[model samples]
Target: MAFTGIPFAALDFYEDLEADNSKVWWNAHKDVYDRSVKAPMAALAAVLEPEFGQAKLFRPYRDVRFSKDKTPYKAHQGAFVARGPSLGYYVQIDPAGLFVAGGFYGATTEGIARFREAVDTEVRGTELEGIVAAMQEAGFDIGGDQLKTKPRGYEADHPRIDLLRHKTLTVSRHFGSPPWLETPDAAVQVRDAWRNMAPLVEWAEQVLQ
Candidate 1:
């Protein structure tokens, strides 16, 4: 399907789902979820596939076996284009708005060790810091899994100690119900953010793998 934009009903669907997360509610509103939410999400991912690769849509069912909250449905829908086993670019939609990001969601102990090693070096470390700065300048918020204290060997005095604290590095931003979200320009917005964050994703792919 050609990309148009996310419909307003998509937002409404999520808004109601947040209140009643039961199967009864879902069955009654199943058509809205399929037509308004899932279709646009698929369309949005489709247009970006040429440059970003195919996106995998997350199943709406929540995995409650390991979680405390037993909510049956997800409040948001997300799609991801992976570059490595655990690193990739992403987009999500919900009642609040659109969220776009790129980076490793999780890292193995060995992968994090390698990331710290890269951050300890002057050339690669500073290069990463520069890319992070540029991403912030372009309006994306930086976040992801992080350590509470300095890693075992890295000193508090280390110049890039902050960067070294990250176990999973990512940049994202929420664009809340913007007007463009209802038009084709929404795809362009996602493209621009993904393109801008390519360096960080590339850096993680190299260091983590």
Candidate 2:
């Protein structure tokens, strides 16, 4: 279903948030995740009108516990909100730092190597690095202070190429938007701030892709 300015209950806001480590949560609330976050993103993609396939969502669980720094899930919720023939825009929902953007990254270790190579070799030398550097200048940190390049050990020739995960500010609350979400730039405005977030209903739809 699409968001038509309907006022959902506050419980709806926390459904996905509360879906931590429980199959029950995943089974019961996966639909909620679709509804609350992915749906609105799809709507935005429609409005922005990308020239490629529909948007899609990555899985939440990352098994990094064996590594030095372990995270239960990614801090940012995202989708391929819009796409051009060559590149795509990822509309990320970071409520703790609620914002959105378009980009690429690898979800696995081998994929991460290509991702790292791309970022270090491709992005850092191009306009994307400027955007990443700008976000850093604005106070957001990458992954964490420890892992700078990208996580390694992903499968080679993976589907997700040049995928780099982003981190929300550590200081922000677990569920609130960051202060910088209101930057005057339209893309930054929609991509970074929660007050003017694209409707969750639409985001829910995009992620289902």
Candidate 3:
């Protein structure tokens, strides 16, 4: 089926789930989830696949083996579009709203080493700084874990100290629960946000390569 849009019921489903996160409640409302939540997400993924590459929807079951909270199902639905193991675009839909993000959320050991090396180089480092600055100016939030102090080998007074301290790098934009979310415009908004972050995504891909 062609992508229409996410219905209001999807958001409503999440809100209800948050209030009653039990198997009984979920089983009763499974149809609502299938029609409103999962179906629309599949459609959204289908629509984005051509440009963003293959879409992979995450399973709703949470791995509670190592965690404290044992919530059976996730409160939100998320998906990623990628060509291979490389990071690409991501999307999330929940009660809060829609979130679109790109870039390496966390890199492999080799990827992290390459990323730091790129930041240590003058030309590539400056280019990354510009990309991040522009993304911030465009209203996207920069995200990732960072070291409180300088990294092991990096000096505290290093020029790209901030970038060098980052363990992972990513950019994301959030849209509050807007009326457009119930319509096809939600996909359009996500697409535009992804497009805006393309330069940063490309930069990361190049550096990691």
Tell me, by lDDT, which candidate is best. 1
lDDT of 1 by residue, 1-209 (tens): 87889998899999999999999999999999999889999999999999999999999999999999998999999999999987999999998989999988898899999999999999999999999999999888999888899999989999998899998899998888989998999999999989999999999988888
- Write the number of the candidate with greater TM-score, choosing between 1 and 2: 1
Candidate 1 regions exceeding 4 Å error are: none
Q: Indicate the residue-level lDDT of 198 in model 3.
A: 85
Q: Provide the overall lDDT of each model, using Cα atoms, as 2-decimal numbers.
A: 0.93, 0.40, 0.86
Tell how far residue 3 is off in model 2, in angstroms.
5.1
Which runs of model 2 end up more than 4 angstroms from their true locations? 1-20, 51-53, 59-76, 81-87, 94-97, 102-188, 191-209
lDDT of 2 by residue, 37-65 (tens): 55554554453443434666655666685
Q: List the candidates' TM-scores in order.
A: 0.97, 0.38, 0.94
Where does candidate 3 stray beyond 4 Å? 83-86
lDDT of 3 by residue, 1-209 (tens): 76677887888899999999889999999999989888989989888777777789998778889999988989999999862245788999898878889987777888888889999999999999999999999999998878899888788999899999887788998897888888888889888898988887888888776
Alpha carbon lDDT at 196, candidate 2: 24
lDDT of 3 at 183: 82
